[model samples]
Target chain A: MLKKETYINGFSSINPIKDSGNEEDVFRCVEPDYKTYIDTIAVRRLGKIQRMALVGAKMCLENAGVNLPDAIITGTGLGCLSDTEKFLGNMLDDESGLHSPTSFIQSTHNTISGQIAIMLKCYGYNNTYSHRGLSFERALEDASLLLLENTENVMIGAVDEIPDSTLKITQKVKTFYSKSHRNEPVAGEGVHYFLLSNAKQPNSILLKEFSSIEGKVSYEEILLECKRILLSAGIETREVDALILGTNPNIDELHYQQLQNELFLNSNVLQFKNLTGESFTASGFGVVLACKFLLGQTLDERMYLKKKHSKAQTVLIYNQFKGISHSFFLLQNV
Target chain B: MPSKVYVTGLGIISAMGVGVSETLRSFSTEKTFVRHPEILKTLLKEQYPLGEVRFSNEELKSLLKINSKQSFSRTSLLALIAAKEALFSSRQKESPLGIGVISGTSVGGMDKGEYLYDGYIRKNGKFNLHDAFVHDCGDSTNKIVSYLGTQAYSTTISTACSSAANAIMLGARLIKAGKLQRVIAGGTDALTRFTLSGFRSLMILSDEYCKPFDQNRKGLNLGEGAGYIVLESEEILNKENRKPICELTGYANTCDAFHQTASSPDGNGAWLAISQALALAGLNAEEISYVNTHGTATPNNDLSESMAMKRVFGEKMPPFSSTKSFTGHTLGAAGGIEAVFSALSIRDKIIFPNLHFQDKMEETGIQPTTDFKKEVEIKHVLSNSFGFGGNNSSLVFSAC
Candidate 1:
């Protein structure tokens, strides 16, 4: 292994919030002036997910002060659902095998990365992973490897959208459906992008480890993986100041709570999925929130689970989907 | 020094047939498998020819000994069939240093999802909600990993047609990073009404057999199948006491950054990928013995790829062919199956011909090999796979 230290130079996320005291703003992104990042003409043709990804990518690059990166990689678990729903509805209504290609084109999983590539004219390594919860982790893994292999700069993003139709289907499903708990984490959308570089910059956040375990992993398995990562980084479990847990009372909250209690006992554990909701790439939203917490920012009252810890140095963000797969990531202030 | 990744085993199932021998037989016998699909329940079946795997979903499950009680999508079944062959051919009994699986799929379990969603939307009948949730891209990877009875890090890549090549590239990267000693990396996709309609809407589907690099080429015939290659670190190959099929020496993925659905006229992405892969392998363009071009036979792709080839090789181009003319355009699995063909080229020293070719494009004037089978002294082979959104990837394979 090259064991090269990777750093996040810049980050941006266009995510949905649960409340705005208004109906239209309830489920939409309140961050990023889309018009500032996207042109007037092009903005009309792009969908919400597309526009969010473009704005997030541009903001990431601008924050890093780099015009173009060596690569643009992205992950989307529920890929362009609004456009896909439109296309599918058209197909269902008219089975003539003919329709406008615009919706169909935007519905592809690679459309986000490809759109970024087109916007930046970045003719470098580009890829998109759509493997459920592992989507963003795969993007992160690829970005890290690129840095390790001497690629100077890479942009990694993860985005998921819940169109009304798709959200209806998700709500009908048993896992995401929770009529009893109104404030529970549910289907929300987000687009998160980070600029990663091989060279460290001032105030850059060091990415220590990003790992995932899939398919019916036990509690011990999760603990062992966490131990391996911490051991490899020469950091003790007691040294971790804050832990980010993917806890949702509606679904899959107990697993994370158990993990926190078993492995990260007495740490200032935090909750992110509560605010980000249950999108497949909610891990991205969680990690971004962790980055915020690690940057010496005070916590929002809703975000802090236990009492806030003072003088934080390292944080761990762990998330899983329906308890079938688990992802563990460790980050340190640099 | 960076670690070396070796291709120890390969398995494939396509319109050509099942297993490696069947695919090789199609190559040797020059068989045409594109026809009206019996498996894909699409309304456009009569309007377009497809490269559908011969076996039906139930028959495939039976072949894999999967019980009827458990639901398996056509994509997962095809993936399992091909992956089992790959693991067997790898000849490793257990994972001593841990293993992983990285699969690529353009449409994972969409065939099943389309049916179930129709039931839910139309309220036609009771749909299995459980199956609906499993219709994700990662679901196919999880199913195949479980079938192999191993607990390894698994993920799915969905970069459209360049997906499998990207999967192979990631696998090689992991091995080089010492993340794992052995990995099964490939791609699988089944013919679905969603993709058939989507491609149909794109208006790129051909009504006839695809002809690569032909001046009168119409378009590509969409294909469905699975192809997997077991890539292990050199340490594993040495420990297992098995001969490697080939060495995965070079890979590069570059985006055209030109258009969403069309390749750039300059072929910037393809040229950069080819040049970079050659550079990474520490070889010159002239040293590539054979080239497996991503010749989907589409007018835009053939011209762009030909221009890229001309840019990379100039007048010193080696024998090259697009196997898609034989197996149709296998989308996500194209890279995996093409890599298999590239390794077979290095192992057998034979060049599979591009099936239909009468005239070359006027601008490039680069002609693909048209003979049925051309025996050659091959050592290294380069393969190309390009997808929509201008994603282009190239891989280089060499003899052990």
Candidate 2:
């Protein structure tokens, strides 16, 4: 937990979901017009992940009414996979010939955050995390530390891109599948960024607490962890207006189902991957949705698992990836 | 006041050697390990000089007692070896939970991914399960965690070459923040055709041994290895009654925001990182006894770093040297390996020399210590690591 108060001042996301009205499995980002944010010549060289991240970062700052942040931290699991594969393929094919430096340069994981700093010309603290499921959480943890140290604003983002080849391999190999259960989630990717601030703004939502643990965790352990997180935030289970569970079309909905039926029985249970699909940093989309729900956005009917007679003031997001990396976030309307 | 971060143990494996003692012997004997690739099978093995680890994957697996059937990347294997030593050296009467593991790497499992890519992508060949897994950067960190038998919070940072420096910085912060009592922090990278080819394409790799801070210096020799240090909080140090090797006084990270691959001529980012780190340590320029430079021996880096050092210390510059000459530039592992070297310098009161130094550069007229010295009253050591994406990091280790 942070010693000082931190709030989500602004947030933006570019996802693959075509629309929220239907349950469609969109695997890539429904990109925005890049020329609006990035110039034409520059856009040609930028990869899909880079362009989406740049635009999302720009929109996040604009929404927060801030020009430059005190720090830029980003998280990406695969990190410009298209460029990485491109460079690797080019090298394998050519063997001895000269290879272009552009693909190699952009293939680095930090390029996302580095480019953001370059664009802003803000040379403050810059960091990038590439952990599997905890990438976004690690970046957030760093931002929380900065906030406690009195940093005013921090621009943080989590992005991952799945190339067609990568998607095909993982799908064919049943990488996402558990031996005992079926995998129902489509492989998806996107870029989600947020402007976290120590000071409260008009549209700010209080980021109460967030924590994560990695191991071969059990369902009971996750249940206890969620309760502990809620306890630390000084909120009772009944007070949680909505419980945002990171459930995809996975056959092993046992964890989510048991948590809903036992722990937060009175709260409205919801899912976000229906619109955003499942990826390493898909919990980032859940975070954005929590912020929106705190700000009184009407609950999307497509996201509901169980609707209760409660308002959307307090939201607790619980995400467990492959039963290995488990995390949670608590937000409140302030 | 924030808690003080102490270096409790050290582990390193490079062309220098496998453990701390071997590494020290190499430094004291002044034996340069630059040679052709013997362990890493590559088309450019004989074409370019490298600092390859003198062990094959099978040998490494047997040494570490890992089942050969389990497919672990060279990156994970190297990390496990180093991290295991660190954990063993740092153990007290009882092991504890909440020991965070933070690792840095540029190419996580590319050593394995490069070979499997063709088979998986083209569908013309069979994919071996052992080589198929452990491709991401986090895989190495996870391997370290499971091997150490600690249910700890772990993560991986990939900021190119400066990765291990940033990892060390983050570990210190976590200790200071009272988040974790003990943390294993460093970086690991394995040589692969992908990196060799990338540098070859850039036309920066030197055919000869690297000559850092030298006038007619060629580029750096690519090296492969892992380096790690166990950091403990003040409270843990008191409870465990363990002697600290040194104190991590300060660390700072900054981006040049200038270019992706090349640093600015003025070295603005390096300057900021150095000055800020000094300010945090509450030390003056004269208080620093030695510096471990991020001198990849590249034409641009040595010159840019020289300008930054001049701007920071002026005429009162400390005796600085680039150990990359001995270990070769281990890329992400350079920072971790150099940090261990800095701690060793403080612990033993000795300074490692820059190998193959001939002439001072004309641009800055800076000269590094060319001979190994012993019995020096070393106190504070500043180590710099600059990488691609304009990432610059400097760490200050003080004698405790």
Candidate 3:
């Protein structure tokens, strides 16, 4: 079967960190201007999750110069955490009285996707995926499938928000950062959007191929799969200049180290999670970082794993959400 | 340029019944299942009606033979039950045909999440971290996959009410793309106070039976159920000499981008989706034998869908009906449930009645088939599912 080529024509993100377009600049911590983007009255009703998604989606479309996309596909690990917490809290607090419907309505997993479609007046294919870590990757896969089927101009993204109630709950369950580790790192909200097109554009990075895997595949096995992808793109592993690894200091260091040893034995290894705290769809932020790295931008100190490296020619992005949904993508500079 | 996708098996558990046979029997008998919420414990149980599956969580867990002390959300248990029945009906259990599972769900384990949230936050309350696992919508799909004992490919789609329809669309595309030979595609959603209150807040919940396309139609009654269908590629069907129930001829998904929770007044998105599906199927609107309208009975939905149908069919619209009167609005599961109903319509040569229609809407002259009809040769059936955020999908199923 003849394969249709797809390219990432544009990208944007708005997180706890700075917004997109300032690649060389990095902020250690972000104090977002929520009031500027959201109305005070609306802000009262808006949960942190909805606000983050709305702002990020707006920024993505503005960056992509797309008034409306053919489809809107989004992924989230925890959907509307703040609203979920609020609704559940209210339900348990008073079982009978009329509860505020805003939180409950927003708590559905597809709210973000629905909001994006509504905001854009994009009555196209709108879908959301919530698969723990693989959420964003699954959305990407669906976007790619649409492209392959001759659908054009899709907006695909991942958004995750940090809710105080959820944070407290996770802490109580010991699934979140402990008091001892709170100062070490803080969870942040982020939204990364990509304008994918079948037609390659100038200054665009060709999304050669993407593959999702589950379970623990040996390093050799992963390398084999990587080779097949690279081979299909008519490139050699030796020809690749840099490898961008989604290494979270908390959970992914060891796996990143072992995988790097096997795949990038000779190539330069670059890591970026230290600059951006771990989130379900943080791999998407990593993809943006890889794109910048491939565009000949200098790496920030917080994102570098090694010293200065040669200009990146071809870059490989390998991300796993929670050691389960492993994904690989090979990209080449135009 | 088009691909062939076959629906070999169908399974569903709704307020109407537990299996395909039961559901069909109810449909044929013109039995309406909308009633006051019984299985779910809620304050508005007596005030609002719901299309509930009439089984408590404990009863469902026992029936599924699951002994895990950890609670299974109403959604997961319903999904597992429906998916298992689908796999059993297909009889391709041990066959290595690269089977995949794609489910559409909106709330997922919110039922469990709602129960565990307070416990997790309050130190005095016992909290199981495992319960948080249900917070992810994909967890339910993952659980279904594990229960099936096959993992060629698995994913979940959540686009509000259109989720399952989109799941079915993706499953068909995967087979057409030769990514997998067979896939179990559907959606499951259970009634929760969260959704009920949410709809109530929207002022769209009906106290009596939902009357779609009626001038007096108040709003939709929320429903809880699961639906699944086994889709196989033509190559696999030919190799195994399997019988196909219906052919998933074409599908199209388009967003309305009209409002956060309401469809466009003109139904532009719905028109595009229907036109695209018809174009892909290489058929005209006149060729459709019947249409399963995404009639949620809401003042907005019925009007919008009716306008779109008139735009596509012009003066010659096919026989159409909204079965939501039977099962209510199943949310994410509505697409899957209605898809099964479409296949049944094709196989059984029947048109399920759209109950509780009193008067036609002033805006659109379209009235649904209000009584069950038999011996009708249904060659091609169009199923529409539009959801919150303007997500609109239309699927075309043809008799095998």
The candidate that wins on DockQ is 2
TM-score of each: 0.95, 0.97, 0.93
Give Cα distance to truth, residue B153, candidate 2, Å: 1.8
Give the DockQ of candidate 2.
0.71
What DockQ results do all the predictions give, each relative to the true complex? 0.69, 0.71, 0.57
Mark the regions of model 1 whose C-alpha exceeds 4 Å error after superposition: A18-28, A178-185, A236-238, A258-266, B93-97
Model 3 over residues B244-288: C-alpha lDDT tens digits? 999999899887877667888998889999999999888988999
Kindly list the per-residue Cα lDDT of model 1 for residues A245-323, writing each as its tens digit.
Answer: 8887445456677777877776788886556677788888877877887888766667788864575889988888777
TM-score of chain A of each: 0.92, 0.94, 0.86
Name every residue pair that clashes in candidate 2: none
Question: What tens-digit string does per-residue lDDT give for candidate 1 at B143-257?
Answer: 8878887676677999899989999999998998988888888898888877778888887888988888899899999888888899999887777687899999999999999
The residue ranges of model 2 lying beyond 4 angstroms of the native Cα positions read A20-26, A177-184, A298-300
RMSD of each: 2.3, 1.9, 3.4
The native-contact fractions of the candidates, in order shown, are: 0.69, 0.62, 0.69
lDDT of each: 0.83, 0.87, 0.80
| Model 2 CA lDDT for position B133 | 57
Find the 10 residues in a row with the least total lDDT in model 3 chain B. Answer: B115-124
* Better by TM-score, candidate 3 or 1: 1
Error of 3 at B67 (Å): 3.1
